[model samples]
Target: MELKPLKGQHHVSAITANAKENYRFYTKVLGMRLVKKTVNQDDTSVYHLFYADERGNPGTDLTFFEIPNAGRTHKGTNSISTTSLRVPSDEALNYWVKRLEAEGVEHDGVSTESGRGSLAFRDFEGQRLMLVSDELNKGVEGGKPWEKSPVPEEYAIRGLGPVHLTVAKRENTEKILTDLMGYRRKGSYSTKIGEKQFDVNILETGEGGTGAEVHIIERPDLPIERPGRGSVHHVAYRVESEEELKKWVELLNELRIPSSGFVERYYFRSLYFREANGILFELATDGPGFEGDEDFDHLGEKLALPPYFENQRDQIEARLKPLETKE
Candidate 1:
């Protein structure tokens, strides 16, 4: 009777205003591999790209939907407020500080809490970032370090740390994540915004800190967010295989939650739905894998498409604006 529909956080997708700059930060600055380059299934003009460890392992992925010239998202509830990535240790954090400083990338100095160290920054679209020290992530098997990236190997981003988001109301969403999704509430913490104080809910993914922490804050003073550039598009959770995926779909259905049925991703099968808070949630299987479409070492060398779009490759590529080389 262990029905943990959420195996772990598979990936988090955000909206990026510029594909090139987004690529630069994720690949050159963050040292994450561009695991997949595909188009948005709904809007073919925009790219749905994924960056992750070399093999694009579930919990390690951070994805984006490139909206060429979209404006910034309004800050409020219903938005992914921050994303944390696990780094090796406190020493490694110094390396990142130096790296980001050298590149003129802006960041807030390291903040320590409960013996944990974190460095905060913002992406081009103003999405907040927190880099943390978590030794358990060192030497994690699949990802490659960008040799030229200023961030050192010892401090390289291991994967997603915990995706922090703000919500309007916590009832329905909390119920889904805790009761139906099986996430255990770790504890609560408070943070201040202006003169207002807000309590944050901490949920443990137990998949390790890489994709382990999920924090949701409720701010009544804040307005709802409109998805655009500078906003998170969706958050995906991992599943062991297709069979487990079916079980998850059944459980979600039993709870009267609507979901997108199983869709094949070449690398994994997926389903999606939105929690009441407005953040899109995706359920992706972990099998078949990045090796299914390309070689182990060259997974993202070229644009990849789902089988349904195979015949339209030429057209798709033609529509895409060329990406600059990253060294």
Candidate 2:
């Protein structure tokens, strides 16, 4: 009867065409701290960047792949269309919208679609992001706030409150999220996009998105998505420890869900797989985090690699460009 293997949302990874722009937007513009800067193990040419709060907490972390030359991503059902972050209040949301607009970032007006207040906008690389007002979690404040941002110090982005994923069918995806992932349908809201009525499902969470919440959208009529430049790379679920992760792997196998072998990611072990509905998901353990190999205050300063890649640090560093481009 217990199908949900994951405790809650661990993190969300997306592809970025420009490392410099992406880094600046997440840290400088959005006021999140650059937790880690490393090379992608799969592709050393691109940089793997993690942004989170000052402490580099689990649910607050958002990872990105920086590929300067990746082609445009094709939108379809397989892709994750939008990632939502929870803020403190509507006043905070309004402040962020104005701040982004003042900086010429461009955003939709304040609106209420699903009993939740939100401000939506697109990132530099066409990634759709929304800031929803959820006052449940009291996120740690204090970071280099973007000078031009309207979001005040007391009411800033807590972390990923709820991530909205678009899937091909409602049944299979819903089963995985609620049954296998341990999420409950808090409620549903509808919005008019073009000529269609988009149904959005909100899942309840105690932690308010720190491995605590997730939302799924049933876009049945949309075509399949092709993974590439602009699409989401993967979504990772959080667990308390390696023991919990191992339990999940065993549970998945018992349920007949195939998975990639366990991979030691230094900070955490990872297991990868695709759900029936067609989205890449990862089971990530939170432990020795970004500070494992580097100092807490000075994360994301230089190229950091796992122990296996230590021997080839030179080659790896040479292959990738610095995320902070000097103007």
RMSD of each: 2.6, 3.3
> Which residue window of length 10 is worst by lDDT in model 1?
137-146
Q: Write the residue-wise lDDT of candidate 1 on 179-259 in tens digits.
A: 767787877777666787678887765453445667888776678887778778888887778888888788778778888
* TM-score, candidate number 1: 0.91
lDDT of each: 0.75, 0.72
Superposed model 1: Cα runs more than 4 Å off:
1-5, 113-115, 136-150, 206-210, 324-327
How many Å off is the CA of 198 in candidate 1?
Answer: 2.9
TM-score for all models, in order of appearance: 0.91, 0.89
lDDT of 2 by residue, 1-327 (tens): 333345566678998888888888887677777778887888877898887766567677778998787888778775677787767677887788777987778688778745567888877877878887764344222123323333456567666756777887767877776777776776777777788877777775434332355666777677888766656888887777887777777888888888886778887788888887878889888676877788865677778898898998988888876556322
